[model samples]
Target: MKDVVDRIRESPKLPNPYHIGEICVLLPKDNPDLRGKAGYWGVVSHVGDYSCTVQTWDGDYTVKIEHLKLLELLDEDCQFMQQLCVRLRQLHQVASRDSSVDWLLQGLGKQAKPYLSSLQAKLLAAVEREYKLVWKQPKQN
Candidate 1:
């Protein structure tokens, strides 16, 4: 049992869904509950010990380890990418569709992630500053 657990943990095929856009395939041979999903692809939302949390068109599932296969690794921070896409689309509405900004944002998906993450933080701070956002303090337990 120890050796089996060790091997599972050490397996390079195990999906580590640290960021958004990490993809996985379902291997449902050993699990009847996932039989309908065999060969289907899912996006990893979170990772767990025995199972990973994956999102599909239908919904998210807590899938067992043996039922998962790593498909694609994340190239950048997904949340930042999603937010940037939304903001860029809004900017596109104000500017021309073929504007330089739209072209630049499209290429950011392959850029180094740490810089994008820092940019995301700064953008959020700017929004808060411009809007003067504040909330009441929460009560302590």
Candidate 2:
């Protein structure tokens, strides 16, 4: 199996602004069809030469080498990174204050209401469930 170094080398020569565990603001490469719109901003949970994993504010996405182009490190991006850190801290605080499941349910209920479509709602629920599972404390009864 390939190791981390191998994965890192596989990517293009351009330096990536993201580091493992650092939050990043991601945007889709320029595309006419997309009207040059910015894509979702997310946290860089893992970065390898061959692949990167971004935990977006809305969901998680596994990005391959070919799909990536490192965005510029900017002040706005820094602000988002700070926000992500604060959000993570808040999540931990809430989870510790009450059962994680309860905290997630309450949080999700408040956060997910804007997606009106049934399919979108289901998908969001599934994503939230996975996130909760990934972060849950094993000691909780």
1-141 in candidate 2: lDDT tens per residue? 578889887866875545765544444554332232244445567777556786644345666544444444565554445354334444444444345544443443223122225764464345446556333322523
Error at 35, model 2, angstroms: 15
lDDT of each: 0.52, 0.48
Q: Evaluate model 1: give its lDDT.
A: 0.52
The model with the greatest TM-score is: 1
Candidate 2: residue 49 Cα off by (Å)? 3.6
Candidate 2 lDDT trough over 10 residues, lowest sum: 107-116
Question: What are the TM-scores, per candidate, against the unseen true structure?
Answer: 0.39, 0.35
Report how far off residue 28 is in candidate 1 (Å). Answer: 0.7
Q: What is the lDDT, from 0 to 100, of the residue 97 in candidate 1?
A: 34
Residue-by-residue lDDT tens digits, candidate 1, 7-72: 987887745434445656667887777756665555667777557776643346787766777654
